[model samples]
Target: MESEQFRRSWPFTGVVLWMCLALPASAVAQDEGARLSALELLIRSPQLGGSDIPRDLPGPPGGVEVPLRADASTSSGAAMAGAQAVSATTLPDAPVRPSSGDASTPGLSEEMSPGGPEGSSALLSEAPRTGVSDGAPLTLLPESSPSRSFQVLPAVVAVVPGLLFHGLAPAIAGDGQTARRLFAMEGAGLGLIALGGVPIALTGASRRTIAPLYAVTLAGFSVFGISALANLYSVVSPTFDPGVPAATLPPLELEMGYQYVSDTSFDYDHFVSLGAVARLDSLKLEAVARLAPEDGNAQVRFGGAYRLLGAPEQRRGDTDGSSLDAELFGLYHRYPTEGFIVIGGDLGLRGRFAMSRVSPALAGSFAEASIGMSLQGYSYPGPVSDGNLHEQLLYSFGYGVWLGRGGPFKGEAMIFYDHRKDGFAGGLRTFGGGVVGNFGLRGRALLTETWGVAAEVAAGGALVGRLSLIYALGGES
Candidate 1:
């Protein structure tokens, strides 16, 4: 009877031991699950002001801790209570026997411990220690808040006296970086004006230095104008996007158009023109022909250009960064009434620079310059007419903007000076028949990917206008 009683007591002892081992594992699993669920709820809650959470919250002693705003503390407290209740239900009915002080009390609510649910609730009620712990709530100003009232004043100032004071608007607005750049640009412009103006004045505006001086003076004015515009733009629209989609020129293009000349000397008023272009890697070939049907006059030009510097052909896009090119061209002209023919060949250089990096308002801005020398032979109906070759210089410089990259509408506008004294303008003479230069405006706008229109107006020796339709055969859409 003694051996049987010992055996029965052994089974009861084994059962108690098993309960002690299982309780802690069950409690750990419950705690982990509760923590994960609470975290998920908190993250999905819209009351936390989107996803901008504080990064410096302190971790709890044995688990993760999330700092809660004052409005969220009540709901979080309820969640902690539910987690404690669930942990309690998982405990075994028989009390877990503690071995030394190492064993945790089974079925004792976590909320009742020193670092318990109440302690966490108290911590949550206080603002996060990162920055808002001073008892004041965190508040963000609205986008159109009254504190930004001073912005409009800068815009007004930028428009009035700001034209002369390039950086004043940005300086007043506390943008030192932009202000410095604008002031530097204005200084450079002033320096250029002085450099060009003083010499011209000292020399009494001699004809020999007039052209170069005029160019430098004009460049200074352009710089001033651009800087003034930039100042106004910076204050009025501080956050404008200057990005244009990358675009590339096509391999082939075709164009046809009509031109109207308003020359007092020429009887021919209308002409039809055809043009074609073939582009290869770093090389371009082009041909153009114009005919005056009533006057029986015609002109034809052929040319090829090779890129010497800048990005390669494969890298060219709508925003062609910068490029320098050399070209060789030949032209043939037939005059009806004058009964003369002219043939010429020219060698030239062309360069373009993009200015998008300077300012958003001038995103598509570009400057171009071309210079060349042409050798020509003239023939007339009379035997005394000489066929000797004559040399002529050709040069032009312009500034413009490229518009509508990665869009249906695409175009360019430019104001330029042309030094050629030919065509209807050649017959007229001023100040002892000296050649007069031309000032011109040219623009081309495409309505869609395949078709577009162009117009040009020039005034100087003679006034001229041209209109045309353009089609792209193969290129960027």
Candidate 2:
């Protein structure tokens, strides 16, 4: 029984020894397989193996540290060492992994890091850091090519034949929409002039209907001028970005200035000028006063306008700077040396058109016009003469440019013509002083939200210049 028991115990001990020896060998093989799998996964990873992928390697302690060298000899040495290390761990018949020859293959170097050397391999140099954690491909914007007509033809045509035809430039430039609008505008203007002019002629320039008819005719002329400018602008617009209108303006403004007038027909030489403007929702009111202390000559004029179309002065928004208004004004003048006091009233229509609507190149430029009639009577201090009521045709037109981009320093400068002969800067004395009006250049700028400056130089029968200080209140800053 003792022999049998010993034999059984010996077999059991042999079995335990065999299991202890085989278990460690099996675990070693599994670990090697897992390591190979991990290496394979890393080499095939999208982040590491792509054509545009960066060649940076994670360093030491927790990662497989591999060094890459620029020189062929150093690279060969590193490869040999890596191969040896793999061979020492694997079985004799184990397959060796092949190395890739692709330029995008990951390599270990300072050039691969985010703070890498500026001078790196051509492939690495092409990659740009896209504000990401690491490398990204560089992207460049495409350039645009301008067409022949876009660059040259339109502008030329607009100048050569556009002045008279109004729509010729845009039509030839293949802009049917703009051309159609321009043609329509021209036709409308001609029609209005005919409508008003025909009646005035048939009625023998009758005073009973001259006021309204004159106003209509002036409106027509204004429309024609606007359309002509627009035609030129439309063809030239491709070269520039358009300007935007002011979204808002000051509600109230006050002005004071000094005026010097050199007129052979008038005795007043120096005067004090005062003016004020008030803007409501859709209405604008203005007042002007000029006093000559040395000559005892004084003039006061007050007026208001009601908006019939487009945005108000205080809240224009994104409008094209186009507007139409009906205006009424009253005037008083005392010519102390001439011994006459003139009192008058006026009624008219005023309109403005933004040049940008016609073309981007003309942005910040505009056209303005007003037509009306003034009725006045002269009162003499001494009874020596005729006291008959006089009628004067009033018309004005201007071309202006906006000053300064949108900011506190916003304003406009204009070269204008005024056809009234009763004011301090009256019509030219040439040809009986009634045929030609005064031409002037005026500009106003707001230096800050509340303070500004204005200047005007005018010529006619007299040379007149005025400089004013402007103070603004309320509304938008």
Q: Which stretches of candidate 2 lie over 4 Å from their true place?
A: 1-139, 142-162, 167-184, 187-213, 231-242, 355-363, 382-388, 428-436, 475-477
Which candidate achieves the best lDDT against the true structure?
A: 2
**Model 1 ranges with Cα > 4 A deviation:** 1-246, 312-320, 382-388, 423-436
The lDDT of each candidate is 0.63, 0.69
**Tens-place lDDT digits, model 2, residues 156-235:** 77777777777888888777867777888889999999989899989988989987887787768767767776776676
TM-scores, each model vs. reference: 0.57, 0.61
At residue 142, candidate 1 shows an lDDT of 16
Q: Per-residue error at 244 for model 1, in Å? A: 3.2
